[model samples]
Target: MRIKFLSIIASFFMVSFVITSCLDNDNEVNYSPDATIRAFELDTIGYGVNYKFTIDQVSRLIYNVDSLPVNADTIINSILIKTLTTASGIVTMKDQNDQDSIVNINDSIDLTKYVNATEKNNFLVLKVWAPNMEVQNEYKVNIRMHTMVPDSLSWGDKPIAENPAGITAQKQKLVTLGDNILLFTQNSDKVYSTTIPAGSPSDRLNYGQSWDSKNADLPEGADVTSIIRFADKLYLLTENKKIYNSNDGLTWTEDNVLTPDGATVTNLITSFSNSDGSNHKNVNGIASVIEKDNKKYFSFAEQKETGWNITTSTEVVPAEFPTNNLSADVYATESGTLNAIVVGNTQGLDSKKDTATVVWASEDGKAWIPMEIPSNNNCPKLVDPSIIHYNDAFYICGKETKDDAKGFQKFYTSPTLLVWKGVDRMFMLPGILPPVKLEGGVIQYPYSEFSFKGKEANYTMVVDRNHYIWMVGGQGIDKIWRGRVNKLGFLIQ
Candidate 1:
């Protein structure tokens, strides 16, 4: 088909040139054979032009290698050529009837009509004339523009692809290790993992490797729910009030940090990182809460060369502090400031008529500070919320118990951890999609947008090294999905 299309245009060029050169020749003078359109341009677009229009002489086509924004299609309807450079030839548009009109740089041209129509020359044709009076032949003009929103979050319909681990468990977590990500699922004291390979953060609908046995197991008393990554090692607290470290996610070893005196390990908070260059002895550590004498306290232990440097906060853990089903992580802001935050449930939220989720921040891991958020209807009861710092903002995803919304609804985002706002439009969850049916079969609504009737268990959202948002597993929905903002997938990012 491509060969046939090119032959037709080639024949047109040959016939047009032959007829003009074989004229009566009353003057017997020479005419220049050059009839090339050197350049063409519209104004700079919103995202700026990453590529310019390339004139392909062999294919007789003029196009932009990279696409313009979606509005560029409409913009071309009345857009004047801001720059049109030819080989000093008179440019004109010829019709089917052979009637022609001169084309000027200021004249608007509609490029969207009959674009991608290769079977015929039914679209507008811009011709360049040689020194002679006759015009030259066919050179199709094609401009490509994006069909999807550049910044809006795009998700797939439903699972037509393999669900990495192949089994849906009641709970799962995503852990990052440099270039790869691990999806860890626990069931009946047996834990499994699937490694997701790393690459560019483009439009990836499905991602994950086959499940492996991992060839490792946890200690008899190690808590699987409290495992966290600290610096280069994975740490978890055991039932003996001893903190254990593991170079790999499996095979734990005893560490120096213990739940001192008679306290038991409550839970692991998060890993705190130091990005401060001035601190020559830049240290990293893990934070946790321990209960002793009926009072819970914040505890942090720094990773040392030989042993661990433990520090327990003197301030008593507040009653409003999140205790269970917590999600936490450390992320750096745009200005290079590091932040460690934890968000979950506190027993007192049921008694309050305001928001249900609580947030706390820490600098050195030991001193915990509550970040105040607006107490309003915008903040829902985000039970088992998974918090992630992505694209410079923090996003919380979980089940909404307040109004009884379905499908893990409402992802709240905040630039500053203190102020959060529910995203009603842009960022949304993957909608439930049904299998495509025959001509007379029925399809479902909420196919690709957020669905309130959909069913998906609470899951973890982890950002990969390349910044792709990876949805690992829901208790009921064992699916691996990778998504990224369209602009973030651009080469500029």
Candidate 2:
């Protein structure tokens, strides 16, 4: 009878112990703070749905807690937010709307109200916390005044009929005449003009069936070197040292007064009053650089009441500009109130020894002044730099070589043509593909001439009114490509 009593007592004690353990387990709380506030989960109210917000619209910043553990009781109090302007190194703190006060989970903060008006592209740092003032997590948000990214090169339909000879006909010159884009072919004596249609995609070049070809008044087998627009007329300079002008791109009139005698007109540049009337005091004239009898001459033609008053300047003679050969590759453009010219000789052909690339600038293109090379350490020796004045700045694009191998193309921009800043290489367009190696290891692209020189020396780029960059035929390649520059100066696809 005593043994039975002891057994009952042991059973009762076992039940009591199990009940106490259950109560302890149920009452346990996880205070480890493993909850995360993901950046992607942050909600943006107003403006657009994307994480990127524009400064023009009012935006609300909030965090969603749906992804957190359901049984984890996480509490969020206040968010410490700060903004950093990208263009300018300016920092601002979030002070509006009692943002420093305590806030609950899913509470919102007005972001646009705290952002300064001078802030352009910016980044936001949001430090979230729990009710006990313990930091929860931090997130970064990108804000911009403009959301459009740069575009990549978008090739259009062949402006000309493909040559039956299987050779890609070279497009020697590309110029924007008013609202039309004029193209001059090296192998054909015709000029093709097209207009970009409105509402076209970034990768689409609107080469509508409205292509117009005019008989470029040139001798048979002569190639066009440069094309420019001055005084509401389009001018074409050819290899035969001739100048032709047309009020409309269809008709042509030879301007013999501006022609150089026995010299090839290698480059032509013109500056005019800005259409927006921002630069009304600037001169409206045309300038051409020609190589004659082993001499380089700067020819300036000032716009007159009726026609052009031509003047010739011999300041850039061969004695002063000692290029290897008289036929140096010259590129010219008008930047603000200055006319800048870039001259470089072909490597291994015209330049037997290493030569420094030269740049010259002039207000009237008569009294030329040499520009100092940029003092930046990263500024490499530019082989053949292409200069263009687009989007209120002068851009020089070229390639730098290291250990005899061509590096990716680089771009430098200057606001006043005096100081240059090397932009990031990401702003450069896609480079040409590597050429097939010949028996002697000579590199040549398909359908290209058997030569060692790369296409960097022969590229022609032009910027339209819309800031769309149009690349003409490069060395040994007749295909065309174009891309657009965004406000942030990035080149995007």
Estimate every model's Cα lDDT from 0 to 1: 0.64, 0.47
lDDT of 2 at 465: 57
- How high is each candidate's TM-score? 0.70, 0.52
Clashing residue pairs, backbone N/CA/C < 3 A, model 1? none
* Model 1, span 191-258: residue lDDT tens: 44555554555444344534545645666666555678766677776566677877767667886555
Which segments of model 2 are wrong by more than 4 Å? Answer: 1-171, 198-222, 259-277, 289-297, 314-354, 373-384, 391-393, 399-403, 413-424, 431-458, 474-478, 488-493
Deviation in Å, model 2, residue 183 alpha carbon: 1.9
TM-score of 2: 0.52
Q: After superposition on all CA atoms, what RMSD does each candidate show versus the true structure?
A: 7.4, 16.5
**lDDT leader:** 1
Q: What is the Cα-based lDDT of residue 161 in candidate 2? A: 26
lDDT of 2 by residue, 1-493 (tens): 0011223434554576578668896664333332233223324322322232323212423322212111111211122222222211111223343233222223444344223222544444544443222334443443222233233222222322221212343535666777787776566757777776554343334453445666755544344445566647877755555677777665677777665556666556444433423343455566766667776787777777687776777666433342322111122234334344544444343443333344556556555565665454223456545676655566666556656647334566676665776664325443422337889888774422321124443545666655577655444444455554543232121
Where is the poorest 10-residue window by lDDT in model 2? 68-77
